[model samples]
Target chain A: MMDFISYTCLIVGVIFWFWGTIPLLSERSVLFKLHSLSVSDTLGSMSIIFGLLLKIPREWPLLVLAIVCLVLWNTMLGYVLAYCSSSGEKRENR
Target chain B: MVGHLIFRLTIWFLLTANLSWLNILIGLSISLLLPRGYTNPETLKEWLSILGKILWAIPLAYIEAFDLILRPHNDEDMVCEQVEKKRSHRLVFLDILLITFTPKTIVVKYHEEGWYEVHRVTRRKKP
Candidate 1:
């Protein structure tokens, strides 16, 4: 049963990763594409990590750190990218 | 606060993942030696309150996301734009931290005068 669940999670994660890319080809605004991509990507990666955690219970320490870093770093990177683009645009309009 | 110390200790234990007496001693001493970042009691209290608000807001935000995605509505094509002004950097950071995690809202741009342009799906017609 555990093996079955693990494989299911792995497959679902892969599906999410590919699904996120579908939005990238759309004509939506940059931020909209970015939002869909990042959110789905993060969720997919987190699901994979959780599956690994289940597979290797002894490696809880590293897995826990991965989860925390994934949540914090992804959001920070998104904000930084958004801020940098806007600031650059402001300089150009001046 | 005791809660803060306990939280740190819990993280320390999780990182170390060993319950030996020497490890405990090391963790205790190191945590004690580390400087507490907040000095002002009032500021700390204010930060704690803000944190509480963020925690409370997170679940509601996710619920809102689910409603927006799963329900059919006429305003599906509409995007809500919000320009928040006069916000401190810390507050803005906290907002981004909470908003991005929800999977429905995103911070598009932040500019001078503390204007934060956030893009959210579903037109609520309210700022």
Candidate 2:
């Protein structure tokens, strides 16, 4: 049962990663692409980490830490990227 | 202050997952040495409700994300035209975090007069 769950999580994580990338090839706006990529990547990474946590309960502390770091850093990075992109637009418009 | 110190030490212990005397000693000293920055909550009920909201937001985010990824055309309904009312900093931050965590919405800009421009990936109506 555990093996099945672990494999499922890993598979889903990989699928999400690919799902996020599909937008990059299209002619969407930069922000749209960034949003799709970042959110999917974060969720994929988290799901994989969670699978690992289940597989290796002994190292749960580190795995949990990894999850927290992924969540906090990914969100912060997105905000920073958006801010920088917006500010550049402002300078160009002025 | 004592309560804060204990909370910090407990977190340290949980992160390390070590129960050795040396680990405890080091954690105790480190926690004590760290600057005090914990803010007292007005009420436990308020804190619990905030935590509950966050917990609920996580699942909602996943549902929205999956829907967007599977059906990208639904983005039109998700996107808001404009938000005229001012939101508190805390609320704005939470909304941004929740929206960004999901693939459905991306905050484009914060225009003047409390207006927020968000972009959603959805199909447009043909003229």
lDDT of 1 by residue, A1-94 (tens): 8877878767766776776667788786666665666646666677788888888788898789887788789877777776676568779889
Error (Å) of candidate 1 at residue A24 is 3.8
Give the per-residue lDDT digits (tens) of candidate 1, residues B1-127: 5655776777788888888999998888877887876532335665787779777864564455345345522222323345456555556667667766666666766556655567655645333
Q: Work out candidate 1's RMSD over C-alphas.
A: 5.0
Which regions in candidate 2 have their CA more than 4 angstroms from the true location? B1-11, B36-43, B74-95, B107-119, B123-127
| Per-residue accuracy of model 2 over B65-118 as CA lDDT, tens digit each | 687676665234324445435544545555566556665666655555665566
Candidate 2 TM-score, C-alpha based: 0.77
Give fnat of each prediction, in order. Answer: 0.47, 0.38
Clashes of each: 0, 0
Docking quality class, candidate 2: medium
Judge candidate 2 at residue A86 and give its lDDT.
Answer: 67
Weakest ten-residue segment in model 1 chain B by summed lDDT: B72-81
Q: What is candidate 2's lDDT per residue for A1-94, written digit by digit as tens?
A: 9988988888888888888888789986567777678657788788788788778788887787788778867876776677688679889989
Query: Candidate 2: how many backbone clashes?
Result: 0
How high is the TM-score of chain A in model 1?
A: 0.82
**lDDT score for residue A94 of model 1:** 100
